[model samples]
Target: MSNNAIIFISVALILSALSFAMDRQKTIAGFKRGWQMFSRMLLPFLNILIIVSVVLYLISPDDIQHYLGAGSGLLGFAIAAVVGSITLIPAFISYPIAAGLLQQGASYAVVGTFMTTLMMVGVVTLPLEIKYLGRQAAVIRNVLNFFAAIAIGLLIGVIL
Candidate 1:
């Protein structure tokens, strides 16, 4: 595991212990609530993991390089951005995957676009965002984010 992961785990354990010591009942209740929410998300998380695994397994590094490498240019960036916006993989998983792609010859521009869109433009969560934030605001936010991701990717390409 990474040093950051270890640090986070340690912090979480310490905080949990402190909370339990401060109020056992409330701590128990909090744990129960958290577990319930986690359980609710477990299926969707598993589905994303499975899909990522399948994609990685089926698409060879050579193919990824061919399509998303430095030579692929704007087309690769656009494809990565769209894929990232639609997919729901968690950041922890996505970063390592992005790093692997980079190592396998994918361009920094494409990876930057993918990572930016993955975090900023949540196409999968559009329905929920629209429900909570209103349709107009949600659409506007996503549209802006898409363009921003492209710009950021291009900048990274130029700088790096």
Candidate 2:
């Protein structure tokens, strides 16, 4: 695990122990409730992680090169956007993947869109987010994020 992860875990454990010491019954109940909520949130992302792993395994240099190549025009950009939406991997995983793609000759613009929309926009999590936050909120947030992702990609393409 990372140093940050270690520190967070240590701090959380210390705080929980202090709380329990102060009020054992209340602290135990609160901890259990927190754990239940955490598990509920984690369950949904389990499928996304599995599928994204499969995608990473299946994809290769030539495959990324041919369709999402420098010469593929808007079609390539569009494809990258779609792939970014589906493969909802975390940023730590994403950075290395982007680095590998760069080493293997993927365009900077495509990678930029992939990285940005991968974090900012989420088609995979749309149903869950909508269920929790309502349709209007989800639509407005995602629409704005989607447009921003595309603009960022295009701007990078034009500038660099």
TM-score of each: 0.78, 0.61
Clashes of 2: 0
Give per-residue CA lDDT, model 2, range 1-160, as digits (tens).
9999999999999998999899999998998999998788676566555665566568886877776667667876888777787767877657766776666667788888778888988898999999999989997888788778878888878887
Instruction: Judging by lDDT against the true structure, name the best candidate.
Output: 1
Write candidate 1's Cα lDDT for 1-160 as tens digits: 9999999999999999999999999999999999998988888777766776677778898888989998897789889999999988878668767877787788999999999999999999999999999999999999999999999999999999
* RMSD list, candidates in order: 2.8, 5.3
**lDDT at 94, model 2:** 76
Colliding residue pairs in candidate 1? none
